[model samples]
Target: MLIAHIPGALLGLLIGNIIDRNLAIKSWADLRTRLPVRAQPQLNAEQVLFMLLGHLAKSTGRVSAAHIQSARAEMQRLQLSAAAQKRAIAAFTQGKDCALTDLRSALRSHYAADKAEQLLTAGWRIAYAQGLATAKQRRILQRCADWLNYPAASFSRLEAQLMPTRLRPNSAGNELEAALQLLGVTRSTSLAQVKQAYRRKVSVHHPDKLMGAGAPPAQLRAATEKTRALHQAYALVRKHLQG
Candidate 1:
């Protein structure tokens, strides 16, 4: 009823928000404890490999002997159980060749974009368990970021803050660019200007928009993660400006 008095634009927004909330709640309820018993939760195939790209980065130049072994070792540990582990490995061996999407309505029937994204975030962490995260690892992670429609820089900044030390120093520029790009601002942007830009960017990147885009599972996951990082970036930059 409140929306009835609003302008067309605002009315549409209010209605959309309600629909998204309903869908999210439904997704939460359906997936709460329904993780596949023997399967790796119904995430996209691209999501799995995109994460594998992160793991593979840990041993890029030396992807010879120990790298794959390390991935397997980590995979074994990350897998929930023996059966899941086998399936995970089988999925990994398929590598870049994995299937991405399925029949349209079938996909729509099976997963709302939000649920697909949740599964994608799960996969990214699994890819990181193998220890070493090199530049190559960052690149693969970037692709995962892209799939989730994430601003790669924002997550990298979060990673930098959480880790405190860089695996390499030179990459800071790359990371910053990623964050700034997500904010829809560039380094040339003044401090005060960034805040407005940040708010606007977050408003647009919301998972709700991704859902409206008919985002695939990977994109939904990416957007969700990016939204989080975008918030973090806004805070960090705001603090930097205040100081």
Candidate 2:
């Protein structure tokens, strides 16, 4: 009778352990299934956007070390899970092969403009994080922004803000003047001064740089909201000055 009781006790313990592990695994699997179909391992819409943007940032054919590092930092700063971050890195390195347009369309289909803009803004920052936003990168970002319903001017403003300081304003337009003023450069400022000012201002507003400095949520929100106005103002200013 003693021997019989010991075997039954052992069997019960084994069954309990198996049940616990199975429950844990099922829970894990269910959580994963709940994630975006396109973005496995990510648990939320925000994480899906990050993964999408990370992929787009690398699509420009540059993919610098700084870009990769900055993307990782942004992921952490945004408080994304480790699994999601790894998925984002992998998806980004995969580049344009992933059909980003479909994802963008889905975002527009499912979310509001503000939410989609956040994703696009993060992508733009990631692309420019490497210190240069090439034409190819710009096009990719622009398309994404457009699909996400972000005003076209937003990209221009962000680009203007990102431009090197040495780029002198040659246009006579109000927009040009405003951009110059925004960068703290006067019409009489020397080319060198212009470059320096641009560098300083650009660095201050650079998303990756701001991320490193632990920028506040309000500031980030403001930047996104105001980017379109800035772009329009910068464009008018650049055209006028350059003419």
- Local lDDT at 46 for model 1: 36
- lDDT: worst 10-residue window of model 1: 98-107
Model 2 bad stretches (over 4 Å) = 1-44, 94-96, 109-111, 162-243
* Candidate 1 runs further than 4 Å off: 1-66, 69-79, 96-137, 159-243
Tens digits of per-residue lDDT for model 2 on 1-243? 765667877989777689767765456687576567783442346545655665656566655677777677777777867777776666555543566664654566545566755666666667667656667767776776777667768767766765545442543344466777776667776666665665565555555655667889887767554554455544544454465
RMSD of each: 29.4, 20.6
Sequence-dependent TM-score of model 1: 0.31
- Overall lDDT per candidate, in order of appearance: 0.56, 0.63
- lDDT minimum window of 10 residues, candidate 2: 166-175
Model 1, 7: alpha-carbon shift in Å? 78
